[model samples]
Target: MKLVVQVKLLPTPAQAAALATTLRACNAAAQYTSRVAFERNVKSRNELQKLCYREIKDRFGLSAQPAVRVVKKVVDAYTALHAGIRAGYLGGERSRRRVKAESKPIAFNTSSAQPFDDRCLSWRYDAGTVSIWTTAGRLKGIGFVGSADQLATLRAHRRGESDLLFRDGGWFLIATCEVPEPEVFEPADWIGVDRGITNLATTSDADNFQGRRLQRYRRWHGRKRVELQAKRTKSAKRRLKARARKEARHAACVNHSIAKDIVAVAQRTGRGIALEELRGIRDRVRLNRHQRAIMSSWPFHQLERHITYKARRAGVPVLLVDARYTSQMCPRCKHTTRSNRPTRDTFSCRLCGLAGPADVVAAVNVRDRARRAWVLVNAPVPMAA
Candidate 1:
């Protein structure tokens, strides 16, 4: 599996300036290349490189590899834009967002991240430093720091390109690392995880990851955001952005903790993980105004992603079962109806009177579905007569 390890760089003032200059130059060159590609109606990498390579090198003062990377970046931007259009992410053809996107060439931010190949960047894991090509010159011995696990991963598995990015007044590098996945063990049973806004996650094992604290945390942040917006000052805007980043970091940390515990249990018990297939969940469900805000801001997908990656690393299998009626179905009697869940927290089957917490019931249903689904998945196909 491919994963990214991000480390913060502690560059000297001189090195930082050079990095800033190089990044700005590369992005500026990318914007110019994008304009040319738009004007000439050319998206092919080789053709666009041929047209802009020499000019970008001469005008932007970039070396051979950086020049090539700039052109490739421009082409990639257009490719992604076209892909988004095809996927209807910007809505229908006549929608304002879609029209606006198609009307102009894609632009790159001046501070956007730039990818560096081996020719432009080299790592020194033993010394915890890096040597990188900059517009000023090659900067050597720029220190970096990361968690012990991340440093170990980088030393053992780091490969391919690394991206240089400036964020929150700091320079960082995100390096790709390819790690070998362990062979999956046959599961003795399954653990079903039900994701929700209020509870966050409820497992068939009856474990609950409650979101009450997180909800209060977000509500406080929301109130602060409104206050800052009312102030409408530059400092307020900066503070607002900081708070948003902090909130995201907190949510991600919570998810990582929850996923780690669940994956550990699954691996220990020799059980597969079952999750509801929740693609397009936002589009599938309707909510009131207050509920809509909570739904939109929920980190259900991130939690699921964490679970998936952790499971992969632990050699535990994961299954996505059908989501329909998981909450409404009676796990005991096999009865399905809307009335089974009369309240948010309660689940009572009208037929057999089976009762439990709604989220746990949903998780049990998920587990049952996965048990059946796995049989079909591994079943032998019938031979033709």
Candidate 2:
């Protein structure tokens, strides 16, 4: 499994200036390369390199590897843009959004992250420092800090390119690590997780990860955002951005905690994890105005990703079961209908008279589906006909 460990850099004023200059130069070079690619209609890395490599090295003062990386970055941006168009993320061909996207070349932010290969960057894990190439020169002995586990992971499994990024007045490196996944053991049972805006997560074990506190936090921030927007000052805008980042960090932390606990339980119990296949959930479900606001910012997918990655790290299997009617199905009688859920949180089967919390019922349905699916998957093949 591939994971990223982020380490903060503590650089002297001189080193910091060099880092900033390098980042700006790389992004500026990238923007220039993008313009060239757009004008020539060339999206291949090799072609872009041939066209702009010399100019980048001379104009941006970048070395060989950084020049190559800048060209690659521009090509990757175009590739991603084309992919988004194909996937209809910008809407139909004639849509204004799609037209606007296609009309201009992709742009890179001034502080956009830059990738550094081994040739341009080297880590000294023992000394907690790094040596990296800059437009000024190679900066050596720049101190870095991370958690104990993160440092250990970097020392053991760090591989491939690391991204140098400047964010919130700090510099950080996101190092990629390839960790070996343990062999998955046979499961004794399954733990089903139902994701929702209100409950956040409800398991078949009847454990609830409520979102009330989070909702309150968001509402407070929402009010503050409106106030700041009304002010419409530069300071207000900066504060707004900071608050948004803080809220996101808080949500991510909650998700990490929830996923760790769930994976721990699954590993300890020798059970697999079952989650509803919730792709395009926003399109499938309808919500009122207030509910829509909640849904728009909901981190359901992030939570699912966290659970999956944690489960993978723990050697616990995860299954995505069908999501249809999970909230409104009778777990005991297998009766499915809209009326089965008479209220948002209550589930009462009209036919079988089974009743429970709606989220828990959904989770139980997920577990049942995983159980049957796993049986079919591992069922022995019959004699050849």
1-385 per-residue lDDT for model 1 (tens digits):
9999999999999899999999999999999999999999997999999999999999999999999988888888899999999999999999999999888888888889999999999999889999999999999999999999999999999989999999989999999999999999999999999999889999999999999999999999999999999999999998999999999999999999999999999999999999999999988988888898899889999999999999999999999999999999998889999999999999999999999899999999999999999999999999999
Off by over 4 Å in 2: 337-339
| Tens-digit per-residue lDDT, 92-144, candidate 2 | 98999999988888899889999999999999988999999999999999999
RMSD to the true structure for each prediction, in A, is 1.7, 1.7
- Using all chains and alpha carbons, the TM-scores for the candidates as numbered come to 0.95, 0.95
TM-score of candidate 2 relative to the true fold? 0.95
Model 1 residue pairs with clashes: none
- Candidate 2 at 118: error in angstroms? 1.0
Provide the global lDDT of candidate 1 against the true structure: 0.95
lDDT of 2: 0.94
